[model samples]
Target chain A: MFNAIVSADTLRATLDSVSVLVDECKIHLTDEGIEIRAVDPANVGMVDLRLDATAFESYETDGGIIGVNLSRLEEFAGMADAGQLIQLELDEETRKLHVQIDGLEGTLALIDPDSIRQEPDLPDLDLPARVVLEGKDIDRAVTAADMVSDHIALGVETDEEAFYVDAEGDTDDVHFELGRDDLIDLVAGDAHSLFSLDYLKDMNKAIPKDAEIEMELGEEFPVKMHFDIAEGDGTVTYMLAPRIQSD
Target chain B: MFNAIVSADTLRATLDSVSVLVDECKIHLTDEGIEIRAVDPANVGMVDLRLDATAFESYETDGGIIGVNLSRLEEFAGMADAGQLIQLELDEETRKLHVQIDGLEGTLALIDPDSIRQEPDLPDLDLPARVVLEGKDIDRAVTAADMVSDHIALGVETDEEAFYVDAEGDTDDVHFELGRDDLIDLVAGDAHSLFSLDYLKDMNKAIPKDAEIEMELGEEFPVKMHFDIAEGDGTVTYMLAPRIQSD
Candidate 1:
């Protein structure tokens, strides 16, 4: 008996998003190393996906398995009826996953799981400041930046009791603010950073509304976001290097 | 001051959808002839948009005004804050519409208004049997057809007491049935028609869940779907020629 649990929509949306950045997906199945990676076709972008194994209600495997063409699985999963159970069965020889719901059936052909590029070696960043904010607030901030700029600087200062997202280009600068009350909680004196708007937008697509996202920030350090999709269901995390701002 | 009222998401979703079919758009303003012509780049697909003066909430024009490049307007409209007011101010020389929301301002460059394509001359046919059904039900039927086939055959007969949508391909055939109880009303002696699933899917995108849609059918006549959108804020009706099924 095998039991694995995750939101169908969340997984579908995440893959749809990450597929936009890379062509091949490499996923590690370590109880602790649940991460997926792919290098952008243009070689300009890379996706580093990390999720906590504790989030899975049940995980039991006598042997490891790998597969290819995750985008096909994502497409089939996207069509899943909301709230419907997504049952996955792995065919050992074909290396295909038969995904069945109550009324729909689809067999997603697997790709060479080994072909996925290795995850980049990111240093364990000690982000000093962390903040818990509403998912919708960050969504709106990203959308505002999408209007006028390609990059954004996110700044959170606990002492100032404010969170600011600023995007400035040759033409105009767009800014979104959330004050003290807007923050569910804030632990300051450590993290503040800037990142590419493109990466943040892609990562934010999978974040469901009402999900409390915990963000870790550090000057010139990579930004990390932890997503709690549902209680005891699964936790998805993301880390992206900050884009250096040239004055 | 010029004011036009439309359903926010409805108009946005519709334009976003139809834009996939055509490129340049030309709208004509005349006392006797009021229509919008959007032609596909290949000249194969055309959307002939027509609305009578009576459909307008308020019509004020000293001389007819024409506009082109609907795609630009659609893009700006998409970015307008949801549920916010959209105002258009025409700059005659540059042929640009200064689009303004309550607090936002932007410009949509217009194409050559004189290059509007001529509307297709479709003759009015006598369709004997018509049925009124729920929008959501038909949408579901079309979606199911989309799963199995590229075309669908619609059969409506009062004697049969039910409407049927059937699609068949190499793998499987799918049929969706809506009974008399499911229909708002039915007026039929004998009627049957078939149309390309592709066009039907495009048409269904304009329909809202709760709207009442009237379908007119006949053996060889083009199928017609009449419904109001934006809570009757505007009217969008379509007539599609039937596809002759091959033996």
Candidate 2:
């Protein structure tokens, strides 16, 4: 069982960060906090989310896994305004979530755990290249590329002093450069990857503007994006499979 | 030929306030200002919009009718941020309206005035009951009704010092009362009319929140709603035909 009073924005950010990658997932509530890890339907991407108890106004729970339909939660979450206190209570008997906001109560039916895919075991693989920057800077580059193509190339140019994103369209292409001066921090590395903007755009939409985003990348390999939300009380990471580079 | 530099808000408000009823309109640019009066497609409603020279940063025009597609203008207006100066130039030789916002120029081809329906003469009938209140108050009432039904009954209670908006659904009904203390001015008469919430909700969506909305009503007659925009430099009036009362 679990009961908590959380700021609406934090709850929304948490749910939104996961809903983009999967419609439903098992959320584990424990003494530490809450954790959700899932993969996209096509297995091209994955999301790992963790929220500490400090993220909520007041939280109490005996560790348990609750199957949640994130899209349904987001629908009701829309009724809440930012900073408003939202009360959440889990009923193990009925397997439902009771959400209350502004004196209105709503119940969301939970899915059966046995009906969902098993949680993915996140591998402990080491990635060589890493760059840290603000989420908005990456979001801006993605938007610029959307105007030109369906995919964007993210990489470290050998002779350049900044991280780069390039998109090539049928008739026009766009290139965006963010030097160390423009970024929160830049680590020069020999890493490059081509990713489908379709996936990047959807994942980026849920990240808050002021979040610090960390990119872990390798040549023609998957890209891992990590960002903290809920004022550093929670973390969300997205791993997207890279597209084969085309000339 | 006509040319003027109007703030993006005034331009947007002007087009949006009228576009709710009619998609295409003939705007008369004269020495006084700009005026547009058009009826909705089904001829059940009419909108009269006027923007004085004071509404524009700079105004100069030789009196002439300029046919405009409001949907096209609204599309471009979406690009402008608030308070940005938008330049509008009517190219008579090419029959196009050139709108420039943020260094981007889009030209809308003007429809031939003779191709559209003729403008209806606004009748000078005197409406007995008038209620002067904030646009937001009435807008709120309309929104409440929309949740229950497509029509609303607007009237004044005989013994109460308040204006009443009532809507009845199949199983539920809602009543909103705004007393004199909540209104700017209240002149109640023996007046009540049933109007489609469909029209009121759409028209109110474009009105600014703080603007004063003057409502004129009479028994079984069309309702006239007047509101000022751009700090009173412009005026917009909506006349909606009442829906016949049903038992």
Candidate 3:
């Protein structure tokens, strides 16, 4: 019902964003583009993704939803080099996806959409603080925090006009700070939250280092992180539930 | 007392060369340079290494022997980036090595020289065929063979004037060939040997890709792979025992 040609980097980025939260996802094929929404089994995190038809070199669709194993698709996508075009066509009759890249061609069996978990609705929250910075900056801070603790605290210091990532271990601590001068943009507000590093680490791996990440935060509330892909033709949003500070 | 300053890359290459065979080794610090010779616990392989004083940024010694844990040294050396100078000083009183790289400094306790295994004498071998080729070429063939089988056969065909690496798996087979023209140099003669990939794979990791590797082979005999390091100021030779082919 759908056919498209996308670069390997774009395909990998698209799959990586959703694969971190769920193994299988339902992809919506529409006249405009592709849409995917999935939540982790524990309901700790969720991902909302959109890849416009403009993101692909060629796109055609009859508008249908298909379920796919994200890991399996990622493996095939990884076979292609950067900038290499990957052609994907749905074989509706055989319930498989025909993929071609370079000289390699293979068919991946699709999962029945009905067997997958239903997509969850995105929740609305009044997250007051917004900060935008390079993905590499956030990734580096997360990596450093992971070395000292299993949980990290993220907050914006209104008085100092700065955003900071902090983690405390049994005997050591790591702290990273970025001021208004260092960030791409910032909307200062009272915001602070604690989140598990386990999920954040996996999510960070899928993010392109140089991509600018927009983050929204609130007091003890879930954090929403957004980033653009496919040359701004696509966008991905990740929502992670925070861990309450027991003390 | 002994003190030396070497690039991170050179130190890594030196440690990697011998660590593949043994965990601990006695390093001979002479007025000229450093020498290390060790055999694996299983006695299936050996590594001989030599580093001239000119390989280091600065070198000084009192001509003594010291035993060290290769893995421990490798960890500290790894802290430095490529081409970054790493200073190593011996504390004779405490029997420790003071390592400094960039802004990081740490001390590693040395093992008693008497506790480590004695160095093995290099065996004299009369190989009929010799081949000089890029380390990457051989590494590529070994890597490809490793995927299909645990053992590989290496030989030179006199009539074809070529060198070949072949491995046969349960259902898959991989063969790599390098004719006289493709290699740096080749001596056509009668030589064939079957070796366990398990050992060869580790040895290959320490060999620099672009370095020219000199290989000597004979029927059912060990392989002597030699390569230069520190821009020819150092040398490493790996010897692996041959696995008999029952068929």
Candidate 4:
């Protein structure tokens, strides 16, 4: 059994991050906090999220995992205004979750955890470069790149000590660079990778403009992006596979 | 040759109102001001707009008419920031309009004024009831009625001295009323009419929330709505035919 009272913004942020990678996710409820990890059906992207028990106003749990439809839960959370409190109670007997926001109440049938695809173990990668900057800068770069091409190249220029985003189309090209002076932190190592803009665009929706995001990159390898949410009480990490560039 | 400089907000507001009725319109430019009158293809609705010379930062003309695509001009105006000035120069020799905003400039080929549909003379109707209220109030009432039915009934109850909007669906019904005290002004007369919600919704897009809209209503007659635009330098009037109630 589990019951928790959390702010509407926190719940909505969690759902927005997870739903980008998968429609259904297993939410693990423990005494310490909530854990969620899911991979997209294409196996090209993965998202891992954690919310500390401190993030909630009231938290209680024995220990259990419940599979839920993320889209449905997101829709329910949308009905509540920002800063509003949301009450969630899980009924193990009937395998249903009771959600209440203000005077509106709804009972959602829980999916069987066993029926969901088993979560895959994330592979450890020794990426060479690390860059940190405000989320809005990266979002703006992604938007500019999308106007030129379907895929974007992200790289750290060690000589210039800058991170750059580049996209080349049949008739147009876009380039954006942020130097050490503009970023919060930078390792300035040799790292470059090309990834699909579609995945990044979806993930960017959940990233707050003011939040600082740390990203790891490697030559011809996947990219890792992590950021804090729920007022630093929660963390979300996204990983996306890179597309092989043709000479 | 003619040239004018007008604020983006004023130009956008003009295009928004005229575009709702027709995609192409003939703009009559004279020494005094500019005038546009167009009717939808179905002839069920009409929009008449006027902007005095005072609305523009600079106005010069020798009496002429130019046909333009409202949607294209609206799109161009959207690129400018609010309050930014836009310059329009007509080249009678080439029959092309030169539009300049900030650093961006484009030449739009003008349509032959004689080839476009001729303007219709608005019929004069002696409506019995007149009501003046904030644009947002009517917009809210229309939105609420839209959720329940395809047509809405608008009437003035002389006994209550109130204006009422009512809609009935198969399983739901909505009714909204504004007493004389709530409106800017009201003339309670024997007036009632039913109108298609589709037309009203499109017309509401151009109505500013703070603007005072004066409406005239008559029993089983078309409704006339007029409001000020461009800081009282311009005015827009819309007339919509009534739908006969099946009852």
Candidate 5:
């Protein structure tokens, strides 16, 4: 048994953060909090989300798993404004999730938990470089790179003492760089990786401009971004496998 | 010779007003101002637009006709933000309209005046009812009607002493009414007519919320909406043929 009250905004941010990488996920609701870990079907990206009890207006659970179609949730949640209060309750007998707003309630059929893919095991990596900055900065760089190329390279150019996002098109190239003082903080190391701009562009939608983002990277290795949502009540982590650059 | 500098907002609003109904138009640049009148290919709607010389930052034009594709102009004008200075220059020798903004100058080819459709003759209408209100009020009513039906009936409810926009769907009916106190003014008469929501919805995009809209209607007659644009330097008139109500 699990039921809770939360803002439409918090729910939207939570689902949107994971729906970008996976279509469905099994939400684990426990007495302490809630957690969801899922990976993209192509094995290219993974999203891990966790929210403590404090995140919900009122929360109670007897420890259970609820499988849901995130794509559908995105649409249902879209109907409510950001500030509206949303109530969620499980209809165990009918295998449905009841979503209630001010004067309306929509019953959504829950997917069988067995149908969803199993969660991926978290990888252990000694990423050499770490950078902290506003999510909007990376969002801006991603938008600029998309105008020029399909892929962008994130790297710390040691010699230049600056981090850069670079993209090259057939006839044009774009590059945005930030020095030490420009970033919130930097644990500089010899690290660089290229990634698909398409993925980054979709990921940016879930990240608000004012939110802080911490990034970890290594030479020819995957990139990881960590951020908080629900007013710091929940944490969302994104890990994307790097695309190899062919010379 | 026709050359003028106008605010991007005025140009966008002017082109958007007529382009909603007609694709190609012949702009007449007379010493008084610029004007265009066109009807949609289906002959269901007519848009008449006029802007005085005062609307332009700088104006100079010896009476001349310039054929243009309003759809293409919409795209070019969209490149500049509202309030930006947009310079329009015509090169008679090249048959080109040069639009200059900031560091960019886009040259759009002009359609041959002979190839465009002939100007439409203004129809004489004796609509019996007149309603004056904010353009936004009609915009809101149209949007609500779109949710329930494709055609909406507009008329005065003499018994109720109110102007009503009514639409009936398969299982739902929506009606927005404005009493005399709620409207700017209303000249009530024995009038009722149905109009396609599709045409009204498209026309609403060009009508600013702050502009005053005057509407005329009669039993089984065409509906005419009039409003000013370009800071009162221009007036855009829209006449939509009525859709027969199939009771």
Candidate 6:
């Protein structure tokens, strides 16, 4: 019998806002670690998440399990009445988590635990460049790209003294420039990279636009984004592998 | 040559929130009168919309003109820098509306005017059962239904009774009940009706949960939802043709 208590709104808000990309549907569960991985549809994008176990009120498991269909759970959490404490009960046989709120009356079925795949080996990369930015800036950059194309080219040049994203399509072309004042911090070399627009959008959904995001970029490498979801709550980190461009 | 200025965030928020169900891309512009017709995918939903000439800083057009892809403009508005004034320029030949925000420094290609469909005619009906509900509560109901099924059965018995939405699926059966306290106000009806989930979700997206929503329901009839959008700065009303269940 495993029981856990968490602010349904908090968890729901995070998942609904994020989880837009990768469909792997794995959330690492440990005494001290928790992670979630889900893929967005081809046009939709991908997300890589790493959260500390401390964020949970009470996290206890004899071992650990991965749950499928996080998007379903996110939807359920979104349905929860506000200010209501969400109670999660894991049923062994049915292999479903029964979700209930304190005052409201209803039971929500979580996707079966066994249905989600476990990726034991997600490559660890040494990202060379790191930058801290406001959530609003990232959201703006994503939106700017929407006007141009589905794929974005990102570059960091110390000589240019700015971080930029460029997208060009038949209908429109867009360029986003972030200066030193707008960026909290930037660490870069003369390196550049590009990735699928679908993944960036999914990853941005996990956090609010106002929250601060820490980003790591490398030449032709997957980008890492760390979302400080709520001050003093916990962190959600996403690392998305870059899509190679064919010239 | 036609040009107008408006707050990007406000216009974007208003349009994005209300156009959730409207498919007729052509928004009629005639002597400050605006009209459009679209069907809600769900029978149990409604969106009430009205933007009088007085709301516009400038009202210049006397003939009806089509406006396509207002939704795409709204998406741009979402990312528009706060307090930025949005400049709109219309070109008759290209049927494109050029959108520019000062600080953002970009141009957006709006939907062609000719491609937009004309507004549909929605006759006025006598909706006896009407009530005001907190936007948040309605948002919750939509979310709850998202978890259980794609269809929702909305019934209003009386103020003394609770507002109910019931959904049954193979995996789970769920019911959401909101009492008078949970409701801002409630009105009763002789019978209830069911609607598609997709429509309800779309309608929900058009209005904020904190905003007041007036719902009218009848036996096997389309649901009428009136939205006091932008704090009465404008109005958006939706009448969804009902889908009669086989059973």
lDDT of 5 by residue, A1-247 (tens): 8789888988989999998887899999988788999988878788889988898888988988999988766655665677888788888898777676543345667889899998987697889898888998998899999999999999887776678899999899999998988898888898889998888887888877898899898998999899999888999988888998889
TM-score of the second chain, cand. 2: 0.96
Model 1 has a DockQ score of 0.04
lDDT: which is higher, 3 or 4?
3
Candidate 1 residue B102 C-alpha distance from true site, Å: 3.8
How much lDDT does each candidate structure score?
0.65, 0.83, 0.90, 0.89, 0.86, 0.65
Q: Model 4, A41-160: lDDT tens per residue?
A: 888889889999999999999999999998888888888999799999998899999999999998998899998877866678989999999998877777766655899999999999
Q: Each candidate's DockQ score against the native complex?
A: 0.04, 0.04, 0.04, 0.04, 0.04, 0.30
lDDT of 1 by residue, A1-247 (tens): 2235455765564565457666557655665625566555434445556555554434544335465576677777777766755666667677776777668878777777666665555457678878889888778778766765788888775667677777665543455666667788777754556778887887777666677988878787777777764353455566777777778
For candidate 2, give the DockQ.
Answer: 0.04
Residues A1-247 of candidate 2: C-alpha lDDT, one tens digit per residue:
8999999899999999988888899999988799999988888778899999999899999988888888767766665677688888997887878777653455667788778777776665577667788888888999999999999999876467578899999999999988777777766777788999989998989877787898877788788889998889899988888898877
Q: Which 10-residue span in candidate 4 chain B carries the lowest summed lDDT?
A: B100-109
Candidate 6, what DockQ?
Answer: 0.30
**The 10-residue segment with the lowest total lDDT in model 3 chain A:** A167-176
RMSD in Å for model 1: 10.5
| Residue A215, model 4: Cα distance from true site in angstroms | 0.7
Candidate 2: how many backbone clashes? Answer: 0
Q: List the residue pairs that clash in candidate 1.
A: A68-A111, A128-A190, A129-A190, A129-A191, A191-A217
- Cα displacement (angstroms), candidate 4, residue B198, comes to 19
Alpha carbon deviation, residue A177, candidate 5 (Å) = 32
Clashing pairs in 2: none
Model 3, A115-179: lDDT tens digits are: 99989887988899999999988777787676558998899999998988877665345567788
lDDT of 2 at B222: 84
